[model samples]
Target: MSERETWATRAGFILAAVGSAVGLGNIWQFPFKTAEFGGATFLVVYLVAVFGIGLPAMLAEFVVGRKSNLNTIGAFERIGYRNWRFVGVLGLLTGFWILSYYSVVGGWVLRYVGGSLTGAYFGDAQGYFGAISAGPEAIALHAVFMALVVGIVAFGIQDGIEKATKLMVPSILAILVALAVWAFTLPGATPGYAYFLSPDLSQLRLTVDTTPSFPWLTFGGPLAAIIPFAVSQAFFSLSLGMGAMITYASYIDGDESLFGDSATIVVFNTAIGILAGLVVIPLLFAQGVEPGSGGAGALFISVASAFADIPFGRVVGVVFFLVVLVAALSSAISLLEVVVSYAIDNYPVSRPQVAVGLGSAIFTLGLPSAWDTAWLTWFDTLAYQLLLPASVLGILVFVGWVFGRPGVEELLRGTGFGDGVGSLWLWLVRTVVFLGVVLTLALGLLTLFGGADPAIVPPL
Candidate 1:
């Protein structure tokens, strides 16, 4: 209607965006990937992708959403030529697909919050986690979790999404930092550090080869497979490419320099994830927990088991779960904002109608996920491998080709940094930057499916 919606305040906007960036992926995905792939090498490749690839692509999406002031669908149609609507539609559907299970996992975080607070999981948390990982309990919790999301969206952007995030993000960050400091002193932490912080090129070579025991994917060698995984994790950890960032950017009101904002978000998101690594990995090593178990319960099982053994470990467990709970909800809210904004902008529907209708639809789709770990893994892998990269591809096409250099330059005009290089930057975005993502995606797909080899490096 009237240039869509804007964030209530700048602080809310940053927090909401940060909330999306910092989530369970930061806690679970980053650490596990690092553990399995070789700590510093994986971290190194991941950092490269984050700044080299993710930063450019994120700025591209910001240009599209902020300039047009629209959700994924509207942003695409307004910017691109014919048939781009299909791409736009795909992005919107990806958002829905992500929310379905993201909220479900958010519910698990809620469950763990109770588990931590009650000291329920402190004794046999491995068994405790196994029992509640899926089925009706998870579904019911998901529904309750979705309702909370609805309440926030119902209040609209400024008052609802922004306000809650402003309080939640800082609190989440603070607690997580404190927990990491405490965990640094865990007894078995030396071996854990040896496993987590030490660089092992031999180990990296093995994982890159996709050894049978460490078979997350197949490639010519651990190095070959790792490039794609690192690239994907970099994007995944940042919550980039999904309409979450694009839609969040759509609400911006000023020339606050998209690169600076996006960079700030990326730095914090990566730090929180590294902090998670510091806390969880060393503890796993300390407890004699196997780094080889890169399954669904990376943090929930091994790390949780470690929590049971420490002095006042139960207290630590509660605080850690609270960190997860806050991070999950904050991300869930950012995702829900995308869908709600879609309906509000495109239809005559009220925000409440949009939230309830779409939220229910997505929640139904997530049933199979809650029923089966097999399905949940498939969904998570699909989102990480397919939807996320595709979303980045969409932005590459949108800003690099559709809107062109002049349009992008105009968006960055009022910024404080280099003002004259807009044309040069736009040219780079259209050609080099866009092509790099394409090559990464194409090479990644080939290396993933085509390059099957057997190897396993020793643990980091």
Candidate 2:
């Protein structure tokens, strides 16, 4: 058997983990969701979800990975829960499922980067997206994006994943901050800031009377709906429940502060998410365009149009799309890594072979998404609304019940914390986090099957 590859340094592991967490969701989906919902209220609820639910659930995955020092499925096996290995399988499948469509979107971002450089999408942002969004061109772009992801993962953990992320994550942060600063300088940017930062309590108030509803079902109402959405966003934004964190944590070699590391990753991810809103919302407002009005093309059309209308538009467009490209690649690498790590651990295959093989498979699966808009929407709804949240709920159950006190002990192993802190963490996981995942899963299913509007459910 070959020796397991480990992250070369603590910082490398954190950067890789942050790279996994900070993806298109942080840049595009989060801002759109916030704008679509009551922005400030949604932001406040999302913060609560991040600390209350996201942190504990993340710690649970970290405990399994670091304690067992194995791949996702093997981590469960090492923890003496043979049947629970299926949870890891679900996590792997969730990552693959998401990346299948995610890579298709990443391909769009890549195409836009080139288009932006040449000012191809400058005048007609919507038309440019329409021209490249489907058919053979989209497939070819998808292949190119998948190839970049495969190339990175094929080099194994230290040489490929860590080094690439070390450069990409820092670059992503810098570009986002720069863009936000530039965006604020625009004439009408203050309204955007007000829309995003100022809470409207009236928007959050439930006007409809609900006297006889079930307590759980009562949460389905307008104001209450934000809770589940916030929880789902926290899970998605942290890259939890997809085996990415578990796989990344498995590469850590020494005793380090898991709690502190998780905190840093969360803080960076949330800051970037909010910063992306700052950049995107203000720019759109400056152009007299409403944020998130472009639906799935919110980032592509609305933001691109705003860029085209600005001074030095071409340069800004190029830089913005470049940032998107880097963020997309960083995330796609982690998604592919989840499947590659499982294959290398279980099968007698080389890393390069597995990376290529799995990359090809996912790209083929994503072709339908690249070919048809309806297919793309269905894929996103399936992966984000159902599979991802379902997988997360399973993990919450396992850590809270099956892993129990032993899991808490593992979580506290390197944190220099006592049992009291560990117990508090465990309590939150078993109670609040567990319920949060359950509600997120339920809300997602309601959106998919119960004929609920996505605007209300807000796909995480």
Candidate 3:
């Protein structure tokens, strides 16, 4: 067997990881959820969830990968817990499941990029989306998007994924910052900032009096419904729970402060997410488009419609969709890497062959989503609602339970921290983080089956 590839530099790994975290989840879904869950209200909860729940969970995966220095499943066996390999399997499956429909959405972003160039969607944004959201056009775009992912991963880590992300992540941040500056100059900027930055705790109070699937939500009211939503959103946004982090961390070389690296990745990811809101919310408010009015189609419809009326709308649309396209590719690369890492680790096949074979299969799976929006919804519901949270829950359990002392030791390596911090993280993983993930999964399930409005659930 050949030696495993590692990131050529710490910056490469950080950029790659941040690139994965800051994707369509930030640019597309974050804005929709902001509008759906009440602007700053959701923002406050999301921030808490990110630092509180997401950070520790991310560290747990970091410990697994850095210590084992292997693929997700192989990490378990390398760590002397072969029986716990199933946890990694679950994580791999979750990543694969997510990237299937995720590629379809990436294709949509690709289409919008072209549409923006020609001012195609500006005339009838909603109608254009409805016509092209699914069918042969979507399928072709999906194939194109997946092929880009395959080509990158096939070239190995440092040469392809690392080099590409180093360029893309910086571009994403710079462009978003410029867009946010432009957005703040709009006449309606005050109301938009007020909506996004000003906290209205009352908006979190869900007035739903009855939840047949999970009655506790009906009683706990705001805390019950919103907390879970925020938790899942943070998890998805940070790209945790799907072995992408684990796979990325596996490429680390030296004992370079995993905690610090994780913190940096989280900070960059959150910054981009907020930057996206700054640009999107203000643009939507300026055009008098009702935020969240278009449901999952909000980015294509509401945002596109806003672009239609703005001065130099065509240029702005091109830049914005270009940002989304870059973000989508960054994320899609990581998701595909998770499975590719697994295949090259366990099988005799070469990286390029495995990439092509697996990419084709994933593309085939996404064809259903490309064929119909309803199938896309089901794919999103299954991956985010069920697979993701469950995968995170399992990995946390393994870190806190099965992998115990060694995991903590691995965590303490680069930080120069004493055992106390490691122990505390272990305790949180064993208890608080563990319970938080369990609650996240349970709430996700309830939201899935409880006849809750599908709009409130995180789409893609």
The candidate that achieves the highest lDDT relative to the unseen native structure: 3
Q: Ten residues in a row with the worst lDDT in model 1?
A: 451-460
Q: How close is candidate 2 to the true structure, as a TM-score?
A: 0.95
What residue pairs are clashing in model 1? 188-286, 207-222, 208-221, 208-222, 208-223, 209-221, 209-222, 211-455, 219-451
Report the candidate with higher lDDT, 2 versus 3.
3
Per-residue lDDT tens digits for candidate 1, residues 1-460, read 4346688666677778888888877876788888877777788778878887877777776777786678877876665554676665666777678778877777777888788667787777767776777888988888888888888877787888888888888888788789788878877688777766666666455323345532344345456656666777777667776678878988988777776688788888888888888888887887887774746576777877777777887788888878887788787777777778878887877887888887888889888877776677767767765677777787677677677864667557567556555666677677776665664565455533444332221111
Clash count per candidate: 9, 0, 0
**Which candidate would rank higher by TM-score, 1 or 2?**
2
Report lDDT (CA) for all predictions: 0.74, 0.84, 0.87
Cα-based TM-score, every candidate: 0.90, 0.95, 0.96
Model 1 off-target regions past 4 Å? 1-3, 80-82, 201-219, 292-294, 427-436, 443-460
- How far in Å is the alpha carbon of 159 misplaced in model 3? 0.6
Question: Ten residues in a row with the worst lDDT in model 2?
Answer: 207-216
* Colliding pairs, model 2: none
